[model samples]
Target: MSRSAPASQGSVVLQTLAAGKLGVWPLVFTVLAAAAPLTVVGSGATTGWAVTAVTGIPVAYIAVAIALGLFAVGFVAMARRISHAGAFYTYVTRGLGRPFGVATAFMAVLAYNAMQIGLVGGFGYITAGFLDGHGITVPWWLIAGAGVVLVAVFGVSRIDLNGKVLATLLIAETVVALVLAIAQVTHPAGGTLTYTTLQPAGLLGDEAGTALAIAITGFVGIEGTAVFAEETKDPSRTVARATFIALAMICGLYAFCTWAISVATGPDQVVARATAEGPELTFNLAAPYVGAFIVTIGRLLLITSLFAAMLSFHNTAARYFYSLGREGILARWLGTTAPKSKAPRGGSLTQTGLAVIAVGCYAWFGWDPLTQMFFWLTVLGGFGVLLLMALTSTAVVAYFARLRTGDASGVTSSILTGVLAAVALGWISVQTVFDFNRLLGLAPDDPVARILPALYLAAAVAGLLWAGYLAARRPHVYRVIGDGAAAAIAPLTAVPHPAVPR
Candidate 1:
């Protein structure tokens, strides 16, 4: 890939994505590319309980699907014009400023690492289970270790390559689960074709908002559009469409599958049964619905799903590092891409190496991968992304504030995004605290939940300190953080292609 001046920072490699990389609806592809529907099956009622604070299962699904969609309203609006610097961190840099970009980069680094390592554990557990079923015995750590290597190798490849692999795992696992759920719904172990526990009232019995929150987290892949902005064809159009369509598709599937789970167990008895079995009820019901094979499949796919999410976020983290490096905050080596592939080679390698070290530590420490890696990493990383979302929302408001000062077109956007920034950030903070083991009216074991939010606060403090140093010493680079992306983009068209003749 040739280096081009898209805008400001020099020598940022041009992208290598095909125009048709994403079809007419890349978001649709990404939605299916995500195994979100299967999350409900594997995560079961625990997820259902979290998302529907005050509503039923369907209501929880609808509320979150809608809120997530609404969040995308401001999100997609920004995607329209800002096509160059893709990733969530990039948007914050452009819309907000460099200091925030630094902060976002740190947060994203933490989050993506969590997602990657966490999935490895999830994968190991699933892989080990499947192997055990096949009459083979192997430690879960070995399986997870293998996944780490495979994902790292694949991470350096093209974006579409990752997409294709994810899509295949997504389809196979989802089909198996869906077929079983339908079979259960159509023919039950007992009597009635429908279930009362799954009824709208039962699912929505209480705590609908809380349930909605957890359910919505299942749709975490929705934000990938922003992350893949540069890698898609006609990003402005592709991203906007993908966002809405992905939300609809995932929400629809989750609603249907959970409903089926309720119906299969009988609404009145399903909750108690699920409670008795613990949260694994989603898979427990599946033994009859699809057969024992699906439990393995779900586990396998989840580990694979984490792999895909890691690859996706690996690209995201590298880009943020590359962008920041180009702006001179970090070492310039991080910004360099492979001359042949034009991919952020150095940063990508750095991420994989970091993950290796993390996995090694887990192994040495005799840590439970699921408990420490997947759970803690995911929670830590997830909140960061949410924080980035709120920050980006604010950045949009500020970016457009100048436009709305005189231009009517930007006024509505400014107002809308500004309001969203405050509200969304507030909700994220509240939920973080509420979920804390001691803070919430729940179990004492959840005490570790508090660490994630504190980590975020610490990262923010570091970002502020770094910003202050930059402002005092190298104010020029600090000032250009907002348009640092423009630096790369400007050079892309700087030399100019000949104009087309009519």
Candidate 2:
């Protein structure tokens, strides 16, 4: 499809997004909603405790938090200067170049799309299981189809409405988890809530890499804080503050809840029990300590957590489409915002349509949504995100190193943290690649595991080529690549118009 000409020639008036609507709390809840606290507490915690061994699981969460925190130092620094819905993609473009920026944008699209679609599988599987426990019979795909409808509706509505819905669900799930954790701590299974699990020796233990990787996945949506910068009030501070707040919340919650589980189960038995019971491990602890009713409530909340995650991710994916569309990088029609709600309705519809097709395919093939689709695809998404983080880290260094006399905060904020974060994230990205098979629950030499990295590589290469084509043919469109997209398109007059369309 051909892109619309830029705004210079008075082509289509570039549509501006809704603005000054989101605040710190709403942004925090929206980003955290994507993390899905219940899923992290119940499923993710159990997996880390069991698959990676219990001793280091809690410590792993903290380490991942630190790594991400370091990454955020530079991330927020860049956000203050460039206020765009394109978070990592924009950072990479501004720091690296148009080609790398475009490539990372495609990578972000792939990663977030995979993540959103993957969460749908988990929602369907978990919801189906939750209903089955209550003696209600429903197909997983049917439930998933219904979710697509709801998410699409929310995706197109006002952003605050989505925030309220997400906040309610996030609070419900957090309350349940915190209650269970508090009970377990107050009435320790072994007569003490020990700090033994938080020790560094535990992190250096066997299968530590696997534990770290899973913990990183739990923080999957952390980087998305900047994605809503365009819509947030005083985004310069709001986005940065929300990023740290979300990070602290995830780190503290995951560490405490996992430790509480360990203490409640008796650290000695935690790993074995978790390995055997999986998600039910959390419920088992809650059954005796928090009551069976709360256990059921927690289960129900888990369903909502997954649903909240789906909705959060649906909004994120829609905005990525919106960013791409407005920049004339993708189909121009996808850039349109609803006149009343100012929502990226076109992108929202496109994402919803993709979800439907994905759910349909999973059902047609009779694949296990939990294992094949959710677990596998989410890991793949995590891999892509890690790759982008590493690239963005490098971009942070490049962007700052070249700046001689901007806000000194940019240089001070980025230089040290930029270098440290680049090394740390780069290491994790490499580790993720080597351990990809383990992440996918496949044999080390599994063909699918080996092939998955190629998908990301191919997308990046294709994106680079496309950026080149834009430079050679669609120069005006390429000039704004990774530049302040929302700013460029926000003003009706400054909107760029190229004489030729690609």
Candidate 3:
């Protein structure tokens, strides 16, 4: 059996990912780490109220979660059938077509890299602030550079080991958040508990679009569950279960924590307090009840929370590189894994290099790490992911409708769900776009407000062009666009290509 023979002809040996290395809980922890519950409650959730001036942040979280839950139904259904590291990319490719898949591949890589790299800015800002408060001085970029190195080390290590580290940090941060929430809820403002923020009506207010867009950022990492499908012990069950579990945990944690803050500060005053105190508002309110010691711990855990998110997103971005390389959409070298640990070393190192460049540029420009680097980049990344989700939902319906393989009713229900999710997510994506300026805290006239969203269009167009080039000049590679490991086994042929999709 020639190693280069087509998969239809015979067996072949090629670089492959480590399989069966993760379980449901490990996956749950990893995805949860990406959400960074502590950071979300302390920073993202608080910032929503402060920046958007929307008092309905708690319900906005619930609204986004419900929309995502609907998105996941089609998402996991597609995941069960296609187990690959390139979750969205593969789904879109198979469901849509080769060119669209390649386009999605590029977008996924860009979005996840933006997400992972953006965290270093956040970690740097928060850690520097924490250290400064303790009479220790350190440059934010220097600290962020150190964090990038740490994530690089773990990115090339065993996947399960990364999961364990994330689990420890996630558990600690979650406990702190829960304690603070309970403390706040028990000692409500004016000695009365209020449910004004939790009312569904809040989601329909004037600034609700901005609030929902901001809330969606908290759930950015949940879709990552499917990215680890190939490494899970049972991709079908593990990916689905981990996704739902992580979603449920994140939704509940975010809604409860934000609502608790509202209850503690008085619903009418929560936004004002958040605007004045910023991220410190959460701890400031809880300190009186939970004590300065617990408050201090929460602050420290906030730093770790950002670090955990960095690690999780790094691994995800690396795997996207690995998948593209394996499928011949990018440099094949990126597909190579470590011989011993089976880690995606090539892809991991690539992500690390990009991180170093991003961090260095921010440091050199002397920009505000928190606002300029973290906020702008992360929100842009979230917007990109939102676009991918909408596309993937449509792909799901297209893929399942074309297959028609399952029970009639089951298939119909799945298709219907996909259509509904597509409609919901599509509307949300539009809302997010319209609210992008508010989401980034930028003025509507700011040039960045347009440039950042334009990046996605640029990526998608570049991907489509490159896919067209492959179809014209490298037909063999073009034939196996989203085949994953099977791409390696596919026979090399020089067959003439049909017209590539526009």
Global lDDT of each model?
A: 0.60, 0.79, 0.83
- Cα distance off (Å), candidate 3, residue 187: 2.9
lDDT against true structure, model 2: 0.79
What's the candidate order when arranged by decreasing TM-score?
3, 2, 1
State the lDDT of candidate 2 residue by residue for 166-282, as single tens digits: 788788888899998888777677697777777878656545566677778789897888766767766678888999999999899998998888888887888788878877778
State model 1's lDDT: 0.60
Q: Choose 1 or 2, whichever is better by lDDT.
A: 2
Decoy 3 TM-score against native: 0.90
True-structure RMSD, every candidate: 7.1, 6.7, 5.0
51 Cα displacement, candidate 1 (Å): 14
Best by TM-score: 3
Q: Give the lDDT ranking, best first.
A: 3, 2, 1
lDDT of model 3, residue 124: 89
Misplaced by over 4 Å in model 3 are 1-21, 83-85, 157-164, 405-409, 492-502
Expressed as tens digits, the lDDT of each residue in 136-159 for candidate 1 is 999878877787677666656644
What would the per-residue lDDT of candidate 3 be over residues 324-374, giving only the tens digit for each residue? 888778998999999888899989999999999999999888887777777
User: Which of candidates 1 and 3 reaches a greater TM-score?
Assistant: 3
